[model samples]
Target: MDLDLALVRAFTTTAGTLHFGRAAEELKTSQQALSKRIARLEELLAVRLFVREGGVRLTEAGERFLPAAHEALAAGGRAVAAVSGAGPAVRIDTWGHLYAPMRTVAQAAQALGPVRLEPGPGRDWPSVAQALLHGGTDLGFGRVHPLPGGRDAGLTQRLVRLEPVDAVVGPDHPLAGADALRPADLREYTLWCPAELTRLDFLRRFADAFGIARRQDGPNLGLDHLVQHLRGDAGCFTLFPADAPLPDHAGLRAVPLVEPVPLYAWSLAWRESARHPLLDTLLRGFTETGRAHRWLDYAPRRDWLPDTDHAKLAEGY
Candidate 1:
């Protein structure tokens, strides 16, 4: 009798985790259904793969079968991906046209082969993250880097660059010449935070500190349009990271915010199980950038903030 690929995958996952419940959850299947698959697998092989007493443990035959199982599944996955055009082709998410300054680190991606860097269809961080979780993309660079718990299946977030929040206003605006700003100084102006970016954790946290709320003033709130409004009498202002690329308009200026506003950073995220060379290349670019001195000095690993690759961000991954 031929062994089933599903059974092999279930066996491998259960063996790797040594827990039926976790393996079932990882496989996105029910425990009962998984147990039955295991039973079928043992029946076909005529060898008991697991022994359950207090908890699951692999049998000698199971240990012997593990390598073959992994090889078979990996081969099958490669074949499927090749035919389906889903992998071996790196697809990473980009926000409009924003990506962190990698300090010549992006050049290393050439060693990994072709990359397809594209924007998420929804044009928001949430959509980008959701696409990565559901296998729509291999990696993502976004503003919102929430934790991997809840419905997300173990997505990984790596902070690449530390960027402070900057408020941009027209050259003629009253606050344009302030040189620096504080939370209290922003009370009078209605800040225009795009609906798409309000979900960023640091932005949301800092906005709450100043009682800033989400409001779109006009039809075009993109980086280009927002700057035009700053050059006009829009009676509004917008926030962006210090590292974000702005249009080459002479009348626009991005001012630094003084203490008390939680800072924001650029993050690269991907699935924990996604082990592509392209993903590793991007991770290395962010990790090996040698920018520990630039890390956020204050409570960087705060609980409320999303999972960050602090070790990598601070000490190279």
Candidate 2:
């Protein structure tokens, strides 16, 4: 049978403690199992390793073997470190809101070294800012909300894209059949904006620009849930990013509101204190990829609008 490092470590630890009961408790194993393993080690080595007269005690052979067992364990630890490439690894955390941009960052990180990408659900903007300042994450992606006047210092924010927010509706709706729609065109329709919509600067701007007031007690659901409602014809409309993938519902259609308002913005955020070589490489990779793809050159394929400014829309908000 092959000698296992775990077995060796177990034996060594048990031998040091002398008392099998105490060693088993420390290792979180039953005394019977610990004794079996100890017996196996002794049998394999062809020597009696311990004495159990009043309390457990190491025999002559065990005394001679302990130093070699410890040295082997230490050597095993070094081998593991070498094999695993053990070192400081970058941990990047992002909110679910920036999934696409976070994916780009994750791809860039793959080319660098070991990276841990942590995706969290909708976190408030203040928690995001605090995470960066506290060195809780190497990088983050989300909408750029204005920081408190004094708190804006010591962070680098790169505006990546802006996506136009539009009202999504069903095919039977009057506006959905129109060639184009304006905020006034939607006045009579029931608007289904999420509760979180008010907190978003762009969504608020769109509402303000169109003079459309949110319904007082409408269904306050998430983006995906609202999309379902729109498909079911439960309500007339819900606000969504023009570039976002529209759910394929037979009755669902998205109409660009006339006089486009910024609905969403995306940014690459990092702290001034994090001056790692990998960070620089990651930024360069993202820039080169963005420029190569000309990500802004394409328009949302869901609905083709002749007069729609694809370039402006691609500036992903």
* Winner by lDDT: 1
Over 9-104, each residue of candidate 2 has an lDDT whose tens digit, in order, gives: 767778756778888898899999888888888888888888888878888997777656755664565467568877334445555352244555
lDDT, candidates in the order shown: 0.63, 0.59
- Model 1 lDDT, full chain set: 0.63
**lDDT by residue (tens digit), candidate 1, 1-317:** 77789999999899867899999999999999999999999999999999999899989998878756865665676678779887654556665343233322353344334553443433656666655654556677655444445544567676655556677787877888888887668777776654444444454555566677644443434556666666775457777766666777447778887754435555677777645455665565445442434443445442123234334345323
Q: Cα-based RMSD of the predictions, in order?
A: 10.9, 14.9
CA displacement after TM-score superposition, residue 240 of candidate 2 (Å):
2.1
Candidate 1 minimal-lDDT segment of 10 residues = 301-310
Predicted structure with the largest TM-score when compared to the true one: 1
